[model samples]
Target: MKILVSGGTGLLGQGFLRVLREKGEHEVRCLVRRTSPVERLEGLELAYGDAGDAGSMVRALRGTNAFVHVAGVQYTPEVLEAMRRAGLERLVIVSSTSAHSRFEFRSAPRLVNEALLPGSGLRWTVVRPSMIYGSELDHNMHKLLRFLDRSPVFPLFGSGENLWQPVYYEDLARGLYAALTKPGTDGQIYDLPGPRPLTYLDLVRTAADTLDKKARIVRIPAEPVRRALLVAERIGLPMPVSSEQVLRLREDKAYPYEKARRELGYTPRAFKEGIALEAGRLREIGLVR
Candidate 1:
């Protein structure tokens, strides 16, 4: 089976491609733009196209039987049309745990797309990954690792009590691969999270422990900081984070992956183990000395 993958050079995309190459079962090709860097994905065939455009996706969809779409859920309509036009039957699209968040504006489109997939008359599976992290390129845990490595103090927002279960990149990629290959996964939505959820403070301490850093955990009030970030963004002032991000830190991001486990055999590594690997990778790239 020949599968076309969008965002094949991205973080999760790279991990998924690595899995496909290791298994060596199906023919895999990456649908990338002409200007995309083709350095890391050396052996895979490249289909130059844009996921945002239906016509471009159609062009890239030529001869591909299935798709591992890592593009945003907002483009599902375009992808559906393009896949139908190209006669592609199978689709495995990535969504986020944020879709389930209380933030309606951020989650609406994703919810709509999840609703749109089941009735589309296609074999579709929605895999919602929670806080993907593995290397510095993850832009999540590695940033914290970098910060912990550099600073002696960790200014945590809120009470640092909201729960989160972040899945490793390779684990998430494997889950996607499972959904792509497993027979009963069609029309199903799977949440791929870590082995267990931990408090934000626990997360910080875990990373801090891994780094063996004696960083001071200072708890700053979240409301005032959120308002300040809002004003800063409105005034074109620079802030490390946005207001929405600040607000979301208070949300409990933990979700059970039992369905993924039962159906896809998904078993994520522990957060400590995952973060340790991330720390090692950051060290490799000289991001965290």
Candidate 2:
């Protein structure tokens, strides 16, 4: 099979490329931005293109057996149209679990994209996964680790009881790969989450355990956290945790992964095991002593 992957330099995209290449059964091609660094995909075939440009996507889709539409912004309409016009009869899209949450500000765009897919002459399967972990450069987990490394006390929001299912990046990648090859997956939506759900405080405690440190969790009220996030957003902080993120942390982000498990045979690694693996990787790079 010939596969075209957009956003191939990203964490999930890179994982897919690595796995597919190792399998040696599919011819993989990556559609990358003009300014994206090519070193990440040195030996793979790369097509210079933009996801928002229909012509570029059409060219990238040439002779492709399946299209993995991983290159989408939070609230971009052009991306959805471009994928539709790219001549891909079969597509697997990566959508966030926030798309299903009422607290998500960007939920409208995702809902619109999902609604527009039927009768559009494209066989589509959308995978919505909860907080993705495993990458050292991951936005969520790594940021928490960095905070733990620098600060004596970790800030806990909303009683530290909001539940989250942090799915491993590799697991999500495998689920996407399965969706691409599996039969009767068209028009299906799979919620790919981790095996166990944990509270926000539980996540922090687990991270601290991985680093052999005691995390001093200080419970902070929601209003103050929202105000702080808003100010950070206004100042363009490099690591701005949005007000939406604050709201999300106050709500449950758990999803039913049984669909992926039963249909795609997807089984995510245990949270503790995944955290230990990431800690070992950090140690290998001398990031942690």
- Expressed as tens digits, the lDDT of each residue in 191-264 for candidate 1 is 99889999999999999889888769988999999998999999999888899998888889989878999999
* lDDT for residue 100 in candidate 1, whole number 0-100: 83
lDDT of 1: 0.89
Clashing pairs for model 1 are: none
Flag regions of model 1 displaced more than 4 Å.
none
All candidates' TM-scores? 0.97, 0.91
Q: What's the true lDDT of residue 182 in model 2?
A: 85
Which candidate tops TM-score?
1
160 Cα displacement, candidate 1 (Å): 0.2
lDDT of 2 at 189: 89
Which tens-of-lDDT digit does each residue in 151-253 have in candidate 2?
8898777888878889888888888888888898999988888898898889899988888889997878987878887888889875546787777666787
